[model samples]
Target: MKKNIYSLLKGKFLTSNGASQNWVMIFYLLTLAIVTIGSSHSADQKVHEIAKLNNEVKELRSIMIDGRGQLMKLKKESYLEKKMGEKGIAISEIPPHKIKVKSQKE
Candidate 1:
């Protein structure tokens, strides 16, 4: 047991006659490590992409809210009256009368 441990510590197993198995295991572990690193990088990129999209969504939502606010202000009766007055269009002093049309039966 002690001789086996000494041989392992001294890197003798890599040079011995049965070292092909050790080399295969080393290659397998290296491949697994590379795959693990690649998967982690892909996950990190997706997380960053989600964060960027979230920020863009928030910005667009705020812009939409701001546009709605401006539209509401523009649609106000007071604002329309002022603009129309500036354009020399005066409001009617008389109340509007709705005429009801009766359909003729044949």
Candidate 2:
């Protein structure tokens, strides 16, 4: 056991005879490490994308609220009256009158 540990520490496992199994295990570990690193990078990219989308959603929501407030102000009766006054248009001061007609039958 001590000899095996010493050989492993001295990096002699790959150069010694009957080292084919050791080489296969090294390749498997390397493949696993590469896959782990790639997955971590992919996860990081997804997190960044989600954060960007969240920021965009917040900005769009604020813009929509601002537009809605402006629309509400423009649609108000007082605001419309003021704008029309600037165009020399005025509301009628007199009340409207209705007419009734009677029909005669022979």
Candidate 3:
């Protein structure tokens, strides 16, 4: 079997056929390297994006906390009355009135 294979491969590799293999191997390596670099770059970009988003989320959370405090302050009726009074508004005490209504069904 070895003798038969050797006879079959005889003079088949004595030419520049193996030289072309070098370029083909280099091309394959270059393609693989480019793909790997591209994927790594994309991963880095994603990490940067995630970090940026995290910072934005932290900023929004801080703003929400500040807004919540402002909301709490504004929820007070006394605060509104004071603020409105500062804006040239006036208030007067009045008596409540009751209304009598009739049903449509007899």
Best by lDDT: 1
- Candidate ranking (TM-score, best to worst): 1, 2, 3
Taking all chains together, the TM-score of candidate 3 against the true structure is: 0.67
Please provide, for model 2 over 1-106, each residue's C-alpha lDDT reduced to its tens digit, 9 standing for 90 to 100.
9998998899898888978999999999999999999999999999999999999999999999999999999999999999999999987799889887777862
TM-scores, one per candidate: 0.84, 0.82, 0.67
Clashing pairs in 1: none
Model 1 off-target regions past 4 Å?
1-10
- Tell me the spans in candidate 2 whose CA falls farther than 4 Å from its real position: 1-4, 94-106
Query: Which is the better candidate, 2 or 3, if ranked by lDDT?
Result: 2
Q: Candidates' lDDT values, in order?
A: 0.97, 0.95, 0.86
Q: Judge candidate 2 at residue 80 and give its lDDT.
A: 93
Q: What is candidate 3's lDDT per residue for 32-81, written digit by digit as tens?
A: 99999999999999999999999999999999999999999999989989
List model 1 lDDT by residue over 1-106, tens digit each: 9998998899998998999999999999999999999999999999999999999999999999999999999999999999999999988999999998888983
Candidate 2 backbone clash number? 0
